[model samples]
Target chain A: MKLTILGCHSATPRINTHPTSQVLEIRNHIFLIDCGEGTQVQLRKNKVKFNRIKHIFISHLHGDHCFGLVGLISTFRLLTREADLHIYAPKGLKEVITMQMKLSDSWTNYKLIFHELTSRESELIFEDDKVEVYTIPLDHRIYTNGFLFKEKENERKLLLGNAEEAKINKAYFRKLKQGFDVINEEGELIKNDTVTKAGSAPKSYAFCSDTAYNESIVPIISNVDVLYHESTFLEKLSHLADKTKHATAKQAATIAKKANVKKLVLGHFSTRYDNITEFINEASEVFENVEVAEAGKTFEF
Target chain B: MKLTILGCHSATPRINTHPTSQVLEIRNHIFLIDCGEGTQVQLRKNKVKFNRIKHIFISHLHGDHCFGLVGLISTFRLLTREADLHIYAPKGLKEVITMQMKLSDSWTNYKLIFHELTSRESELIFEDDKVEVYTIPLDHRIYTNGFLFKEKENERKLLLGNAEEAKINKAYFRKLKQGFDVINEEGELIKNDTVTKAGSAPKSYAFCSDTAYNESIVPIISNVDVLYHESTFLEKLSHLADKTKHATAKQAATIAKKANVKKLVLGHFSTRYDNITEFINEASEVFENVEVAEAGKTFEF
Candidate 1:
């Protein structure tokens, strides 16, 4: 799996920086998370195929997070896209989007679907054969959610020489890969453990932003391979962080350390600081594996 | 008056091209017309100061035209701007913007006034000492409006050497500039033409986009200094233009010639045709002084 950060700033998109938006690639499918304004331009710059984005997950109705959504939908129509698009966002998204389309009198030629999230509790929002996405109900001033993308465990790898010697049938190959013993045509019991080795470990990525430093998320994203948390402020302005319901670099690092995440990627920085290396140094004090998120940077895991 | 083409391409923002957005400077106040999705970036690339944008007029709620508005407003707040920004847009804009702010809880520190347009008829939206902005109802799929930015009648210039020789009092300076001969302490009649020359000739600019070839706007912007109307298609694809409620190069030239505009600027070209010199060449068949709107190019009148 690979993660690409289209924009990582908070509050707004600026001349040099962008708002909250990211792309997660897993199982040969690209999923867009939190499309901020100017995302289409960023997508073009990053060389991400526009037509491949099939699913979009918006954390909330925040302008910085979902403002690019309506434009992207309308652009799809102008591009004459015919693929069905599915959106998973908060409850009011349908009303906001449909109203703009109604006012513009331009409807999409493609099939558009909206899956609204009304539950305050954590729920599974998206799932497929190789990945699953669950909402992490976050504590914020408004209704919000954080998405957690986790890769499903792969089937065990078959040992080539042992499977061939055991005369394993192609139909029973699936059972062997699932770590189950199978009887061969010679009436011999083929031990699954002898014929197959365990597959590589799966990875998980969690995205959290525009939320207070709530410890509740630690349990939800426990042991994730990579954790991208919002660090909107520094320790010097921790007071402003609380007032705005945002997290500082130190708070984000503490959560990453406590959650036992393998690596921590920090973003959604406020436009105050001229240099962002301070955030990296400060977060490194708490969590050793801390990196600052930059626009147009792609992180592969 | 000066008109700058920030972006003029239709649909999405392209590499060298942009969506629909323009800057018309009238009476020294920069007015941004129809902000597309990448307007903030385009504005930065063009080196236009964000603070110089006093008013923004959105023609419709189409994603390509007005999607970048919210981001620009949010960026102004992030810059800690104290200026009062005004927006003239469709009726549902307030609801869409306010709801996004409510959801993110990121309120603007500066004053934001939205003058929503609900009427189908023409209305004067903004007026200052030297300029007036009026809406021109257009034929589009949506409830859209075309804007006419006209320079108001300027005050007469105070002829420098002549005024000094005429012994004009400082208190009567205002009256003298208004082309009224002031009565001196000893009653003396002075010819107004001798003391004052003509001020700068008033120049007007009209912006029409995403509209069909309708002659209704001819009366509103008759004899305009410059008319930048969307010519989405050439005469070869005029049928497609009619189907999409867009105009062709020939149609725009016909409007310009009939309205007696000094110079006609054709823009918002469809992405299909790469060579756009044909648009200008074709429009020049019916009207002289026809130019194609190129990005980052400025025209001073």
Candidate 2:
């Protein structure tokens, strides 16, 4: 899986910094998360094919998070896209986007599907053959949700030489890979483990942002391979973070530590600090494995 | 008068090319026109002070023209702006902005006033002590209007040497500057022309964009000091311009010549063209003084 940070700053977009937006690629699916303003341009700059973005997930209705939805939808129409697009966001976003389209008289030629989220409890939101996505209800001023993407366990890898040595016929090879005992040509039962080995471990990632330091999400995102949490403020301005319903670096690190994530990525900086290295200094004090997110940075796992 | 092109391309913003947005400074007031996506970042890159922009004029409801408005307004609130902001746009825009703010619960601390426009003919929209703004109705796929900014006639310069020779008292200086005959110390009426020349001719600017080749606006923008017109295509693609309700470079120059504008600026070029100099070449064939608008380029009139 690969993740690209298109923007990580908070509040407002600056000349050199952008607001909240990221691209996650897993199992041939590219998901766009929280499309802030100028996100389409950022996508172009990062060399991500616009047509690959089939699903868009928005955390909330704040302008910094979802303001670019209308523009991206409009650009897709201008490019004459025919693929169906799905949006997973809060309930009010569909109304806002529909009103904008009606006023501009710019109806998309393709299908636009909106899966509005209103539930306050964690629930499965997206599922396919290879991956599953669930919503992690977050504590914020407005209705918000973080997404958890998990890859399904793969089939066992079959050893051809071992299966042949066991006198297994070609017709029973499929059953052996499925971790099933099968009868060979000589009417002898063969154990699946003798001819097969376990596949590589699956990967999981969790995205959380615009939320306060709440332990409720720690259980939901426990033991994920990678966790991206919002660190809008440092320890110096922890009070501001509390008042704004945002998380400080220390708070994010605490959540990461409690969740036991393999690696923690800190983002959504407030843009008030001159040096972002301070975030690493503060977060690493609480969590050993921590990294700060920057615009255009990529992480592969 | 100073004009800065924040974005000059059409359709959608790309890695380096932006959509439609510009800043016009006349008489001590800064007006933002056609705020496309990424306009706030463009403003920051151009070093435009945010507080100076008290009024924003939107040309239409197209995404490329007004998508950045909500983000800009939200940023103003985040910055704790205290000045009142006035927006003049089509009637539906107020509803859209209101709904966005309501959903986000980010009400501005400062007053946000909206002037909903639904007129089909030319009309005065804004007026202050030194500047007057009028809307020029245009033909497009949707409801659209261009703006005309006119500087009010300035006070005549008081010629100290000429006034002293005429034996005029300081008490009558204001009246003389107002172009009235003033009584001298010797009780003789001094003619206004002898002591004071006419103030520099009031500068005028007209902004027309996302419009087709329509001559009706010629009368509204006739003889302006500067005219910024949309040229989305060259002569080769003139048919596309007509079909899309846009204008070609030649067509823009034709209107500029017919209206006797002193300077014509062609902008909103289509991304299909690699060289923008072709716009200047095509427009200069019909108009003597023509320049193509580039992102971040400034023009002084």
RMSD per candidate (Å) reads: 2.0, 1.2
Model 2: per-residue lDDT, tens digit, A1-301? 9999999999899988898999999999999999999999999999999898999999999988999889999999999999999999999999999999999999999999999999999999899988999999999999999999999997789999999999999998888877899998899999899999997789999999989999999999999999999999998898999899999999999999999999999999988887999999999999989999998999998
The DockQ-based CAPRI class assigned to model 2 is high
Across A1-301, the per-residue lDDT of candidate 1 in tens digits comes to: 8899999988766678888999999878899999998888888889999899999999888778988899889888888999999999998888878877887778999999999998988899888898899998887778889999988888999988889888978789989888899998788998899889999898899999878899999999999999999999999999999987899999999999999999999999998777999999999999999999998888888
Q: What's the lDDT for residue A182 in model 2?
A: 93
lDDT of 2 by residue, B1-301 (tens): 9999999999899988999999999998999998999999999999999999999999999999999999999999999999999999999999999999999999999999999999999999999889999999999999999999999998887888999999999999999999899999999999998999889989999999989999999999999999999999999998999899999999999999999999999999999999999999999999989999999999998
lDDT for A87 in candidate 1 is 97
Calculate each model's fnat, 2 decimals: 0.66, 0.95
Q: Backbone clashes per model, in order? A: 0, 0
Query: Considering just chain B, what TM-score does every model have?
Result: 0.96, 0.97
Model 2 chain B: ten consecutive residues of lowest lDDT: B151-160
